[model samples]
Target: MRTPVDDFQPGFAGRRSSVAGRNVTILFLSALTIMAGATISPALPAIEAYFADTPEAAILTRLVLTVPALFIAFCAPFAGLLADRYGRRKVAIVAILLYGVAGVSGVFADSLFTLLAGRALLGVAVAGVMTVATALVGDYFSGPARDRFMGQQAAFIGIGGIFFLTGGGLLAEFNWRAPFLVYAVAFALVPAILAFITDVHRPEALPKQEDRGLISGFFLTIPLAAVLLASVLNSLTFYLMPTQLPFHLKALGTNSPVLVGVAIGACTLASALFSFFYGHVRRRLDVSAVFALGFGFLAGGLALVAAAGSFAAILPASFLVGSGLGLIMPNLGSAAMAIAGEDNRGRVAGLLTASIFLGQFVSPLVSQPIAERTGYAAVFGLGAATLLMAALVALGLAGLRSRRQPA
Candidate 1:
């Protein structure tokens, strides 16, 4: 069997010398997934007001923020297949170029439908970027290195969210379209990608006679399925903050875009801090233990959001939510990458990406009606209850796994 070391071509020693550059490049690439939604979240209210005359303006405005996720959910599997068949580098570069074009097109949109169309194309770009970026992480690192890198990757994304969300909020003060300009940053990363990333080769896949479907090959595994489920749930719950929090804050009589940015940035800040420590935490706890811990934090945070009477109360709740997500994000990536083999890393990465984004797309669909009927507090309370149940399940599973282990 070819080791990760042998998967690289010649001149790898020179590449190894610049590992920091390579890691930074990929880390920024990973941040693009978070940026896809976050950079525009602060502008959501502004966009809604701007297009108030449009039918279903409220739902359609939220869709502007989440439509990319729907596209990512659909296109990521195909992106993974392409990466596996051709190369990560080629697909990533093309995606980055497309990301800049589609993302910026929102600034020129005259109608809600035009903006949604651009956002859908942006989603296609993100599917490729997110899939290949993750596959590259798996390709480039293994074992403890992979764990540490996953933690750092999550941290970087959180940090990026701080800047993007805060900046978007500030920019929205000028014009709803101002936030769309941030997507232009994607173009700057193309040069870094070219400088630091190299494609890793894998052995040819199994014969046609032996091959099962890609989804069946990985999804059928209990551990992988559990990880993907966790990802989906985690994303669904985390996204509630972005998709609903602004409206929640507005309902509480605090509607400033900057304050909205700060509130969400507080969550990202906590996520970054906790994510920085994930590798250390992973050393002591198994993935199940981490999941239990993360879900516990999420439950507490959402419960706090449910109970909060003022905008100030939401800040600490945001921190708690961020803390839980910080741990869960890296854990999901590490666990999924550990389960995937070299040959199918791209496909596994793609599916994982799909699950994560799918939950984002579904968040508003699930929470909006609940919020509309019972109010935002009830929606948050329901999320807290659901997460609490998930935490208990994780703890139970952890105990069962421990008892099954040979002494």
Candidate 2:
């Protein structure tokens, strides 16, 4: 095999890439990235049962995904800085290869530790997809085109979630390891990204990257911490939804794979619809308000889920929760990227992605034990509280409203 340097160049790929091609790359690759997390959540209960002899196996199910998240959170800013200095496609391709291998590892692992190892590694790869993918949108695609892709990004997340959640359920019937193998599909997108994509314009001057001392200073800002917390809290809801809802629904007597799949599928559909509407809605409402409304729905939906004692109740609650998520996440991308600024866009988006990865990494762990100890209802309660807090934070930040028209 030729060395990586032999096949790719290090100079600017024009600092941006083609909108149509790049957006397709971002959407499909991100769908795969999001699928990695979603597919695993539904497989957890089965994996735990498969390894029932070790109680800890179930507790650390989050480890499979979260371990990688730790690396993503730590490495995201660095990925951004590299993208800024080097070029987007080069770094992205490397990260994706890592993602593919780590994801594929799940199919063949023998032990719980081995499985966690795969997930952890996959998390690192995912960090690249998350960090660089978002930055790429800003790097290549712009204005309506960028916004549409971002909306589609959110939509694909829902679509991918449906594909994986039910598919995960189906795979669990065969073997717990089978669902994770699905992540290997990411490799196919590599060729598309490599072939069709060309540079687009990078945003006008971004913030100068911070040095080691300034990086420390950067973390100290109240706004920075708030954004990070907001990101964490946000993922806590989005990631935990798939992880926790299945258990809650199962407890309520809707244990059929078909219904469970439908429930997960319905959320994705709702999310798709919300994503479609966000552009117009976002135009009328400020980013912060849109965020708050989305989160407010999250709090309400979780509230309903917490009280639900029967499977019939889950559908409406799922739609509401998914709707809130759909409304908030895409717009959050635009708003947060704006805050991160141009030069440091990569770093800030990287950090934000990291925060999200960490939150997603930890989210299932946050609720699984709570559900195990207290009950599924408690898990929903915790989700509601976190989402409620997110709403308040967004509402407080309403003052940061931009004069620029909606993206």
Candidate 3:
């Protein structure tokens, strides 16, 4: 073996060596990040009821969520910088443990302010975990291998969402505290992380400080921008479907929580199935085509909901939308990373993660006010139009990308 004099710096982000153990560690981190999101959603109604002082006060609980999403959007790039600087393992450990501690504190929160504080803290931690984990994946794998694993991440996260939603739903029926306790899992995972994940960085992982800032101006290409915008739209569609759709159904005189859960759950399940076949589908279809199809599905699904008089109709419509969403994510991520290059992969992925959260933040806030002003259908119309715009942009990007490439 070469001596230490070989000056090998195959740290975590570096391509020094491949180890399955490291991958497992990364996947674990992803699970916690997803779980953080999963757990909060089901308990939203309970949270509102707990703070039933005013509609305005109740909205603060939502801030717990929207704040995290927004913060993740703002802070993801910075987190990546720290990960690449200090070391992936160290960064992940500290951030993850913080996420767990703050996240679990929600269970004991006695007031709205306390809960909000916990959620806000959790958001900062989530930014770190999400950006670093994705960056690590980029460093660890390339090409088909990376594609497959991201698909796996997509599918598995879908599965996790189901568990969180279903379990949180059930718990909300009993007491809201049930879901907040899910953060205990994060705390448990920390020891495993410390034991398994190595703090290595690849030599070519990210450019030096002098070069890093300059790359973003060039790397954030037109195609990549379209995908980021699409990511935001995708999140907008997701949030609109749940929060607004239920209100729409209520206007029709239906309030079956079970039915609502079933609709959203069906949509997520459909997305999971689409994620499973992401690779085969990607090989046969272009990325723009794949994303456009998803956008089409979302548009159709929303339009159907807009016209839906019966809850029975909402289920199939949601599935269609989910299929479209599921198809878009794996392709969007793969395409983004492909164009982003290794140097800015973490920051790019961070941007992607932020877009998703920001989209979620905007969806309900935007759609609800529209619904209140006009009607349920009006909100859906907005979602459909937004999705259609995204589809158009994706197609245009495809054309520009094709013309720019050389033979």
Tens digit of lDDT per residue, candidate 1, span 279-397? 99999888899999999999999999999999999999999999999999999999989998766788889999999999999999999989899999998998999999999999998
**Total clashing pairs for each candidate:** 0, 10, 8
Q: Model 2 reaches what TM-score against the true structure?
A: 0.85
* lDDT of candidate 3 over 148-202, digit per residue (tens): 7777767766777677767766766677787788787787767767665654354
lDDT of 1 at 51: 92
Which pairs of residues collide in model 3? 11-200, 11-201, 12-200, 12-201, 13-201, 13-202, 14-201, 14-202
Worst 10 residues of 1 by lDDT: 203-212
What CA root-mean-square deviation does each model show from the true structure?
1.9, 5.9, 4.3
Reference-based lDDT, each prediction:
0.90, 0.72, 0.72
Among all candidates shown, the one with the greatest lDDT: 1
Candidates 1 and 3, the one with greater TM-score? 1
Which ranking of candidates, highest TM-score first?
1, 3, 2
Off by over 4 Å in 3: 1-21, 203-218, 249-259, 399-407
Candidate 2 per-residue lDDT, tens place, 1-407, comes to 43212233334432345434555777887786667666766666676677778667756665665567777777787777676556677777888888889888888888888888877777667777787778766654455555666777888778777888778778766777787778777778878878755434233232444323215545335665666777778787776666677667777777655567677777777887898677677767777788789999889888888888787788888898889988877886766654654455567777778888778767777777777889988878878987898788787767555534475
Cα error, candidate 2, residue 317 (Å): 0.7
**Collision count of model 3:** 8
Deviation from native of the Cα of residue 398 in model 3, angstroms:
3.5
> Where is model 1 more than 4 Å wrong at Cα?
1-3, 12-17, 203-213, 216-219
